[model samples]
Target: MPKDQKFQKINFDLINNLIIIPIEINGEELTFVLDSGVSKPILFNLSDRDSLQINNVSEVTIRGLGDGEPMKALSSKGNVFKLGKVKNYNQDLYVVLDKEINFSTSLGIPVHGILGYDLFRDFKVEINYAARNIKLHNPDLYKHDPHSKSQTLRLSIERRKAYVEGTVLMENDEDIPVKLLVDTGSSDALWLFREPEKGLEIPEKNYEDYLGRGLSGDIFGKRTKVSGIKIGDFELKDAKAAFPYRESFGFIKNLGDRNGSVGGEILKRFNIIFDYARGQVTFKKNGNFRAPFQYNMAGIELQHNGLRYIAESIAGFNGVVKSEEGSFGNVQILLENKTRLSLVPEIIVSGIRAGSPAAEAGLQAGDVILAVNGKRIHRYKLQEVLKMLNEKEGKRVRVLIERYNKDLLFSFVLKKVF
Candidate 1:
């Protein structure tokens, strides 16, 4: 280890609006989401094929976003954690044993865990969403990147989570000042707690949608768009927003004075730096700053079911060159591509909004998606498949699914909601 090194930059994956990083726990490696909203390291999604050693486990009950009952989890203490050359000993983390609480299917990758707070507290973290990498700088040796347009906002760290100040421009031409949680783990843009008397009102033109999943269960809410938001010198217009029902995200209402949260969808548009040690965060515009928000308009949610064999053909000579005897000089050579079947991910329709186009077209929840618009879904990632469906409002989608050992075909047009 060098004492003069300024920072260590680690490349990360920006998948489905979430940051995925490679981290090691007790010498075994796993992928984790760097969630600013989550305070501690929580592990789950371990299958029978995964073998890892976790030390010191005790059962406990914890609750989060969704409306489900408190989840039972095991708290593991005194473990080693590593990322790049950074190391911490005797770290404490919680592990969920529920197999159904997995994000690998929805994300098209294994999301074994989520970690935050500790990392931000230990280093001056710079997240360049446009660059798809993170820089963990030594607190003592930290230096801010030169940016004339950047603004540093005060970070209020309470209960191991960070919050920022912003103003939401409502549909009625009201600028409502708010204290929003900076939640990188959430994929949506903004989530405003509905308090009509306080000038925070849900627009009349909104639709009920699946917001995301939390510790408790799946969170459903009303989705809409606010006129804009003012954060420092920047203003984002027509930002996609969601109002999580008080019933689903009840815990958020209890967080002292927090009006809502600025999620990854908005955060990704800026290059940000989180200096938890100094109680501040910096924001600067990136390449995605002006990009319009894209939403899933097909009204169907897709998830990984399992794996199926897909045959691929490869060209190769079929004859043995040196050892083959043509039996009197008549040579028969067959040169054709050989067919090879290999395992690939299979996608399934997990949910369909009632009254939406997919439901009208007869797409069931358990239907395994085989192809979409004449393209095999096995060759694409979940996000890629989503892009295919969400490309345009009037895009027609043809889907082939296997249900009850029967192949079924369905067609639907992407209709705009709200």
Candidate 2:
């Protein structure tokens, strides 16, 4: 018997060139982003706040393109939230307790929440990005053909990491064997890279500047064409991909064992399954998976024309930094270790993502970051300052600021939530 096999299977389709799934929240109907990259599920609506029945409170932080702010998170044990026929609740869920969830206001959809790994772990998920559809399968119904194994390739999908372990069948091979995270939240094209190559390869022809923004900031990528990407007896031919060749992605180099991400633009074609508990993912090709719904790719867009800042407010200005500036401000401070440092006095409000040590300490947009633990932030490059911040986690730090020209000091306890 399959897990929850009695629930009716939900069918999805495209509407206005978008993917949407009907959902219900607290007896009200809504739609949510079928996000594969989200570490967990989320509900974003102020109207449903009181009814959410939050059981615990934990300080949560996130880094995105726009001005990042600190907000309260409402969590509860919901083991039975339903999606079409799939029910998941009390399984460790997180919801942003704000006035309104981002989807309802921006996309004009009553997004009950985002569906992520918690539900995907039980089923096979196939995303044919080229066709813009998704397929799900019960493991009991999926059988691996013994004959296909002789020529099929296998990608090891364990713990959200998808790596090309070995080749199953190599007919129209273009993509090299590389470890990748199959990111379902990515609506754009795919990203390709190698561990050793700091640069990426783009198509010599029909090359266009691929522009977009992720959690970090503005990103420029190189567009290219791969004959196809084959995984587990499947292949997607004439696929469009991008290669980001910039300094902002240094952390990607530190992925240590993983390489790149397998985005939605490539995964929408097969009945897919993501078994995180077993560290495996399976996919079966099925073209009949269609829906009459539309959904937006979850992302924040930012443009970086080289701007700088000091603290949360723009230097000598009365508001937050809106666009890129040539320079912001310069400040001199004395470190606790007796080392004097000079730095731009702008507080990094937005874009300092969750799981970062700074976010772990309840740092907010208006809260000025004067020093890293005890090291005064002065006379430092952006990169150097980040390096210093990384050194201090779960440690007490004093932050001094000049908001409205008044000196204010705040003591923060830094932690890591990522």
By TM-score, the best candidate is: 1
| Model 1: ten consecutive residues of lowest lDDT | 324-333
Q: Which regions of candidate 2 deviate over 4 angstroms?
A: 1-7, 15-19, 45-53, 63-80, 84-86, 97-112, 124-175, 194-199, 202-220, 245-253, 273-280, 286-418
Per-residue alpha-carbon lDDT of candidate 2 for residues 140-213, written as tens digits (9 for 90 to 100): 66554433322333445555444544211122343466556666655554566533353334555423342443
Best by lDDT: 1
> How badly does each model clash, as a count of residue pairs?
0, 54
lDDT of each: 0.85, 0.48
lDDT of 1 by residue, 319-370 (tens): 4432322111112223345655555677889999888888999988989988
TM-score on alpha carbons, each prediction: 0.92, 0.51
RMSD of 1: 6.6
